[model samples]
Target: MLQKTIHKSVACSGIGLHSGKKVRLVLRPAGENTGILFALQNGSGRRFLTPRPESVIATGLATTLGQGGDSLATVEHLMAAVRGLGIDNILVDVEGGEIPIMDGSAASFVYLLRMAGERTLSARRKVYRVTKPVEFKREGKLIRAEPCDGFHVDYTIEFPHPLIGRQSLAMQVTPQSFTAMLAKARTFGFLREVEYLRKNGLALGGSLDNAVVLDDYGVVNTEGLRFSDEFVRHKILDFVGDMAVLDAPLWGSFTVFASGHALNNAFLRHLWVNADEYLEEVSLGLEPVAGLEAEPGMVTASAAVLA
Candidate 1:
């Protein structure tokens, strides 16, 4: 498949999940081989960062990518949207330290990407294909991955709550499947936990509007669940996002059990450290690499400024 980027720029603004402060995000097309780049607007000036397994600095309530002294939190949803849509290169411009937790799901990001449109690039796409089966286990959580033609995930989440006992979802992750099956599933938390987080200065922007809050007996939101198995679906969505931290798309069949952000990042780090033994980098179409830069400019002037 050919590499892809957005056709034009798109922007959105919302409240940060942890800071509870307004933030703005801008998406712009990028040149082939740029991968996913972040332009962090901080006190000094703009700084660039590319997502990598080791770049993940935090995974408490969400995944946070950091470099130097700048960091961006709650990036999984947006990253999931980018990878799910098969986009190979793009620029993410952030005015705040955290990505906006839009509805606590990837739906808004999907919509924004669609609005920006998609443009195919001249360069072929590269992906990491798993060559050997590997498993990473921590405590009771586990993540297993093996070779696959495309990205696939079988995820199971277990909770004692009556509304969420044991839920499992398995699917081939494609644009259609991700948008219809996983994009709208919102993050969830218990009522007591939410209160505790707020008291400790966390989850400040969280509310019933963004998350599916639950009490001892049942769900606290009046609107109820988006799907009967929404919890598991959201977990799968998170898994997709976490995997996007790799330099390129990873083609594998993943079986995950009770794996959260911490476990997910740990497994990814293992894969990165043992890449030669477990991964094969394959480029599609075998196109010539010479003289490609002579083509028309792929990124716009505004995007170049951000980059």
Candidate 2:
């Protein structure tokens, strides 16, 4: 599959989840092999960063990438959007330290990307294929991955709350499936946690408008759930975003259970350290697999969303 980038530029502004301050995000098309670049706008200068497992410094309120003295928070949703849409090269400019938590989901980013349109590039796509089955476990949380030609995830999440018991979802993550199934599933938190965060001066911008707030009985949001299993769907969305810390798309089938950002990044770090034994880099030739919709030398935005 060929590389891809956005056709044009698009911008959006909203409230930061943690800062409760206004932030601006600009999405610009980039050259082949540029990968995903974050241009942190400060003063009249910019600090560029490429997301990597080692760069993730915080995963408490959100995934925060830190390098030198620069940092960006709440990046997982936008990263998930980029991964879901399959754009290989793009420039992300952030005026504030955190990405805008639009509805606490990836739908807004998805819409922005689709509006920007997708442009195919000349270079062939490079991906890391899991060559051997690897399992990373902590307590009861587990993440198991095996070699696959495409990105797939079978995720299960369990909460003690009545509103969210055990829920599972399995899918081959294509752009269509991402947009239709995962993009709209908002992040969720308990009422007590929200109250505590507010009292501690954290998650200042978080509200029912962005996230699904659950109480002891059920959802506190009047609108209710987006999906019957929205909690698990959101977990799947987060998993996609967390995996994007890898420079290239990871081709594998993953089975995840009760795993969050911390465990997710830990697994990636483990994979990176043991790459020679468990992973192999593969570049697709200029030939389309039979029955695929795109051309021989091209990968559609929807088909190559993850890898």
Candidate 3:
């Protein structure tokens, strides 16, 4: 498949989740292989910040990617929107430390791209295809990627809160699936977290408007649930967003259980440095498949069985 980018530049303004200040952001088309880069408007004229798994510097209420003298916080939502729209090349210009928490979901980003329209380029998309298996673990929380027909995630999350016990979602990644199924799932946190953030001078932009906040017993939001599994759904959504840091689109089968930013970023780091383990440059005529029983028309498994 060919690389894609936004046809026209678009801009929006919103409040930073942590900074609690209004920030302006512009989305511009980038050349092939540019990946998704952030350009800081500190008067240096677009200092670029590329998302490598190792750039993940913090995982407090949100994920932050950083390098010396450069950092971008709360990037998962924006990244999810980019991945969801299938935009392979783009430049994100931001005025603050983090992207705005527009509605606490990726839906706004989706709307922005739709309004700007999309243009496919002549260059083929670079894909990080999983050619083998790789895994990461920490204290029983784990993330694993195995060879698959296409990009897919089988994720599960658990919480002590009665409202968010255990939730799981497994889906093949596609523009359609991402928009309709994953993009609207809102980010969620506990009631205590909000107070803690405010006390520490964090999440200044947080409100009932952007995130799903739960007290000891039930949701504090009047709107109630968007999906029955919105909690786990949001986790999977964040994974899709963070996976965008791979630079190239990815094709793999990942099964994660009780995973979070730390484990997810760790898993990505393992996949990245060990490129020899699970990286492949492949072409596609149709949407890539996430998992396949065996190579099409191949009898390798049957041969082994007979042997």
Winning candidate number (TM-score): 2
Residues 1-307, model 2: lDDT tens digits: 6888999999999999999999999999999988888999998599998899999999997899999989999999999999888888899999999999999999999999999999988987877879899999999999999977778899999999887899999988878888999999999999999999999999999998999999999999999999999999999999999999877788788999999999999999999989889988777765554433442334533223233
Off by over 4 Å in 2: 288-307
- List, residue by residue over 1-307, the lDDT tens digit for candidate 3: 5778899999999989988889889999888888898988776566788888888999887899887788888999889889876788999999987899988989889989888888878876667778877778899898888876556899989899888888888987767777888889999988898899899898889999999999999999999989989998899889888787868777788999988777778778888887775776665544433343323322111001011
Off by over 4 Å in 3: 43-45, 285-307
Candidate 3, residue 97: how far the Cα is off, in Å: 2.0
lDDT of 1 by residue, 50-118 (tens): 899999999999999999888999999999999998899999999989999989999999999999999
lDDT, candidate 1, at 276: 85
TM-score of 3: 0.90
